[model samples]
Target chain A: MKDIWKKFDETEPSHSSIHHLMAVYHLHKKNGYARGIDIANYLNITRGSVSITLTKLRDKNYLTEDENKFYHLTEQGQQLVNSALSKRHIVKRFFSEVLQLPAEVAELDACKIEHLLSNETGEKLICFMGYYLSEKPEVLNFRLGFRQFKYQCQSVAECRLCESDCFFSGKEISKTG
Target chain B: MKDIWKKFDETEPSHSSIHHLMAVYHLHKKNGYARGIDIANYLNITRGSVSITLTKLRDKNYLTEDENKFYHLTEQGQQLVNSALSKRHIVKRFFSEVLQLPAEVAELDACKIEHLLSNETGEKLICFMGYYLSEKPEVLNFRLGFRQFKYQCQSVAECRLCESDCFFSGKEISKTG
Candidate 1:
């Protein structure tokens, strides 16, 4: 879908750009500021590349650089980083909970999804699923099982139950029933 | 972190390639077979690009193409497509539920995340979150609030608990609590 591509495009950080952003975020989070060489070393990238990225980020008002080679996120930069982090968590939850994907995959996927999702859609989805789980705990188990099987390569038919007892078990029913 | 890049690099699909694959999947799902022109037309991309991507996919044994342009996904290809679809749903749910992101953003984010995540991480995140939600619903609510404040352009200290309670409470909690 065009929409899908658009989403992908929005989140498709130039590999280098994302690398730089992450390095800075990490360094800043741990230390008060980050030096270019330190970031380059951590990222296993060239110092020249880190310098260029830092220059770009500074120009974009996302970073503040000093003579000491140390850099810090500007207010705007912090906002962006926070947003990215939140989106990443959301993506992780989505893969883990709804799709029942494995932890490694979910984390990887969240990195990509966090960049792509529009604010509106992401919020709505979280709200809806959270509400569903709270009100219908029983359905949550069923859905989790279904999602797990689906992730593990089970066919829909294979996951379906044939016996009445299966449906009538102690599991609580929800509106979807 | 290096491992993360390795997975991302390995799974990264060229834009044209993914478009071609999605077109093929859509056409096959709708009509049981996909033609070259049909894919080209649907994607609004050059036939040459489509042809090139198709050739690559063929080389990878993801599809079977005949001289007449008729094509179908190989079992491997079908499996991949199914995985993509499942990821799409997870992404959607994640934005809606955990992040409380808007629908548009969530959908967009999910699309991006689906492509980036490693299968293992994706599955693990889902399983853990599912268990957490079932075992500790309050934690889910806390996470929801935390994410909302963290990502919604508001500082955690700035969030109004009364407002959140009003918004998250009630009988239709399943709808969008």
Candidate 2:
């Protein structure tokens, strides 16, 4: 746990860089071309920042810019985006479908961690979702019971999750800060 | 989705910064006090760097330093740490208990996203686990069926999760780069 946060930086395309690449993919799909300005507009960032990150992405061989200045994700870039997108879907579905969180919170939470999740974990999560959401009898019964069951975790002393904080009573983080 | 990635930066504690505070909390609990040097030693980072971050944390009102230069978390700091730890536990349990992932993998994945998950999502997830893991007959039957269900997702086209990448076939990101 001490240095696991550093592993966050080990992902090939960083969060910002991956989003830049995704801009290229989505813009290309919708408009048939993507340029620096298009990406900046897509991501709602300054064009200068987009240019700087795109140059690094090109140097790393994840994307390419044609002589006409239109950008596109390379096979490697596409793979990374694809991996992230799949992970996003899995986590989003888990939050919204299984946990009954709102669709918007689920999507944003998924986006925050999509590029960080390992391939194995992503695969395993989807498999779990698949089984839990399947048409099997036991799965159906479980989903119904789970939906109707009420949890009664009371005080911190009696709670199994009081090692650091209790989710039920921790003050909400001021997101504006 | 355009700027949702930026929401990652909106968390009160950056991933590295949160761990620095947690180190102080752990060292104090284990040894009854903490100092900049102690945090540096615990995190295996340079002391000068730790001092810089500690100053920033103090300015942000998350921690304090005493006469002998011992460090302590303010009430605000403890709440943030608690929230992050609870989120970490919920995710770790989901990965290991529900998804049946390996312990080490599950822990690392949880660490990677602990501070980033929204508090609402964390609470909802734990409640879901509470019901799913309960001794109710439906839950037990579902667990047994799920443990034995072998998923066979063959390719991207027929898969429900092929919006971008196929987890089963995506190239493992080279963490070394």
List all candidate RMSDs to the true structure: 8.7, 4.5
lDDT of 1 by residue, B146-165 (tens): 44432221433443221221
Candidate 2 chain A, run of 10 with poorest lDDT: A168-177
Error of 1 at B142 (Å): 15
Go through the candidates in order and give each one's C-alpha lDDT.
Answer: 0.56, 0.80
User: CA lDDT of B72 in candidate 2?
Assistant: 92
Provide the TM-score, chain A, model 2: 0.88
| Ten contiguous residues with the weakest lDDT in model 2 chain B | B168-177
DockQ each candidate and list the results: 0.23, 0.48
Summing lDDT over every window of 10 consecutive residues in candidate 1 chain B, give the lowest-scoring window: B160-169
Segments of candidate 2 deviating more than 4 angstroms: A161-177, B155-157, B161-177
The positional error of residue B113 in candidate 2, measured at the CA in angstroms, is 0.4
Superposed on all Cα atoms, model 1 deviates from the true structure by an RMSD in Å of: 8.7
> Residue-wise lDDT of candidate 2 within A1-177, one digit each (tens)?
457767866766688888988888889889999999999988899999999999999999999989999988899998787778888988899888888878899999999999888888888877777676789999989877876776666666765544545756533221111
TM-score leader: 2
